[model samples]
Target: MTKELLTGNTAVALGARLSGVEYVPAYPITPQTEIIERLSRWANEGAMDARVVTMESEHSMLTAAGAASVAGVRTFTATSSQGLLYGFEMLYNIAGWRAPLVLANVSRGVASPITLEPDHNDVLSARDSGFLQIHAETCQEALDSVIMAYRIAEDDKVRLPAMVNLDGFYLSYTREPVDVPEQERVAEFLPPYRPQSGYMSAKNPMSVAVVVLDGRAYSYFKYQMHLASTNALAVHEKVAGEFEKAFGRKYPAVEGYMLEDADYAIVITNSLTTTARAAVQEMRKEGKKAGLVRIRLVRPFPRQQVADMLAGKKGVAVFDQNISVGSGGILYPEILSALYHRSDRPKKVVSFIGGLGGKRVGHTEFRHMVAVTEGCVRDDSQLASVLLFTDSDWQAVKGMLRTAGKGEVSQ
Candidate 1:
C-alpha cells in the first residue's frame, strides 16, 4: 500500500479508477466537478482505461450510465445538489432497469435560497430511488466506500445502483493522507464485472421497457426493489468484512465512540462526524460521560444496529445537517421511529439541526447540543418540548445583535 495526500474528490476518482470502471458520463457541478475533471484527465493520459464523457446535463450523464450498464459495462458518474435534482427523473428509471452502477454524490443543500455548501437533503431526496446509500466521514472513508459501493451493488442478491455521499466542501475538497491499496488487492476484493455476459448484451434481442398498466404489476416490481434493498444491509456487512480483511479498514453501518457506558450520546453522519468525535473526546476529558454514533450506511438505515447501540443510553441528541423545513431535521425523526417501539430505547432523543449550506458547526454548537440532550434527560421532556427547548437557545445570535444594537432597538 502507498500513502498519499489526496482530496476527497481525488480519492473518489482513484477508487473508480482502481475498480476499473469503463464508462463515466459526467456533468460539471461545484465541488463534484473535480472528480469528473480528474477522471477525464486520467482517461486522456491513458493512466486509466475509461471513457469519461462530459454530458450536457446530469440527466444525460445518468442516462448514459444506465445505457452502458444495460449493455453489461461497468459505469460511474457523480453530481451535487442541483445537478442531482436535475436528474431526478432518470434516477428512478436507472434503478428500475436493475442497472448496477455507482454514483458519487457530493451532498449540497437544495435551492430556493441557494448555497454552494453541504447538506444531506440532496442525496436523501433519492431515498426511494432504489439506490443503495453509504455516507462517508473522512477522505479515506470516501475512497473506501466507493470501492465497497460497487461490490455491494453488484451482489447477485442486491443487483441495484448505489450512491456514496460525501459532504461537498468538507470532505470533497479537503486533503488528507489516505492509504492507496494495491491494485492487486482491489482486484481480489472486486473482481471483473462479468454479469449478464449473454443476457444484458446489446446483441441480445430483448425489450427494455416493462409495460405495467396495473397497480399490482407496478407494486410487484417496486417490492422487488425493496427486497433487494433490504437484502443489501446484510450484503454490505459481508462486503465490509471482506474489505477489512483485504485493506485492514472497517466501515461499520454505525460507528460508536464512547457509547458503552455513557449517560448521553450524539448521533450524526458524514464529515460532521469528525467534529462530533472531537466533542465526545472533550466530554470524556471533563468526565461528562458523553458519546457519539456515526451513521455510515443510511439507505438501509441500519435500524437494528442503531437500536442496539442506543438502547441502554439515557439520553441522545441527533444532530442533522439537513432540515426538512416544517418537519425539522430529516434524520431526527428516523432515529426516533427506529427506537420508539424498543423497550430499552433511550429515555430521551433530542433533535438538533445545524450546519446547513456548508455552515460551520463549531465547538460551541457541539457543547450546546450535548447540554440540551443532557437537560432533556434531567427534565423528562418529550420530543416536542426538546425541539422548542433547543430552538429557544437563539441567544448566540441575539446577543450578537444586542451588541450591534448598543443597548437600543434597530432604527
Candidate 2:
C-alpha cells in the first residue's frame, strides 16, 4: 500500500479500479463527473480493465448499470444531486432486481432553490427505495466505503444494491492523504465478483423479470427485500472486521467519539461530522460531558447500535443536514424512534437543522445546539426543530429580498 494525496472523487475511482469493476455506465454531472472522467481515461488507456460507457441520460445510465450487473459482471456508476433525482426511478428497479452493484453518490443540495453545495437530501430521498446506504465523512472513508460496499452488497444473504455517499464539494473536491492498498492485498480482501446463482449468463440464461399477479405475491417479495437489507447489518459487521484485519482500518455501523460516559450527545452524519468532532473536543476541554455519534451505515438503519451509543445521556441533539419540509429534520425523528423503546434512553432529545446547500457549519452552530439542548433538559420542556440560521445568514437573505423589491420580513 502507498499513501498519496487524493481528492474524494479520485479515491472513489481508485477504489472501483482496485475492486476490478468490469463495467461503468456513466452520466456526467458536477462533482461526480470527475470520478467518471478518471475512470474513462484509465479504461481508454488500458490501465484499468473495464468498459466505460457514457450514457445519454442518468436514467439510461442506471438502467444500463443494473442490466450489466444482472448479466453477471461487476459494475459501478455515479451521479450528483439533480442527476441522482433524474435517475430516481431506476433506484427502485435496481434494488428490486437485487442487483449487487455499487453506486457512488456525491451528495449535492437539491433544486427548487438552487445551489452547488452539499447536503443529504438527494441521497436521503432514496432512503426507502430499497438501496443500502453508507455515508462517508472523509476522502479516505469515501474510498474505503466503496470497497466495503461491494462486499456487503454482493453477500449471498444481502443481494441488494448499495450506495456510497460523500458530500459534493466538501469531500468530493477536497484533497487529503489516502492509503491506496495494493491490488494484490485488495484482492485478498475482496475477490473477483462471482455472479450469484441464477444470474443471467450464457451458461445460465434465465428470465430476470418476474411478474406477480396478486398482492400476496408482491408482499412476499417486498418482505424478502427488507429481510435482505436487514441482513446487510451483520454482513457489514463481518466485512468491516475482515477489512480491518487486512487494512488496519475499522468502520462500524455507528461510530461514537467520547460517548461512553457523556452527559450530552450530538448525533450527525456525512462530512459535517468532522466539524462536530472538533466541537466535541472543545466541549470536553470546557468541562462539558459532551460526545458525538456518527451514523455511517444509514440503511438497514443501525438502530440497536445507535440506541446503545446514546443510551443514558442527559440530553441528545440530532443535527440534520436535510429537512423533511412540513415535518422537520429527516434524521431527528428516526433517531428518536431508535431510542424510544430503550429503558436508559436520553432524558431530553432535541433537533437542529443546518448545513443545507453545503453551507459551512462551524463551531458556533454546534455550541448553540449544545446550549439549547441544555436549556431544554433543564426546563423539561419540548422544543420544536431549531434552524441553525445565524445573524449573517439572515442579513444576506434580507439583502436578497430587498434587491428583489420585496418588503422587509420579520426575523
Runs in model 1 deviating more than 4 A are: 383-411
Decoy 1 TM-score against native: 0.93
lDDT of 2 by residue, 63-147 (tens): 9999899999999999999999999999999998899999999999999788889989999999999999999999999999999
Candidate 2: list runs displaced more than 4 Å: 202-205, 404-411
lDDT of 1 by residue, 238-293 (tens): 99999999999998888889888998888989998887788889889999999888
Predict model 1's lDDT versus the native: 0.88
Ten-residue stretch with the least lDDT total in model 2? 205-214
Worst 10 residues of 1 by lDDT: 384-393
lDDT of 2 at 208: 55
TM-score of each: 0.93, 0.97
lDDT of 1 at 33: 92
Clashes of each: 0, 0
User: In model 1, what lDDT does residue 159 have?
Assistant: 85
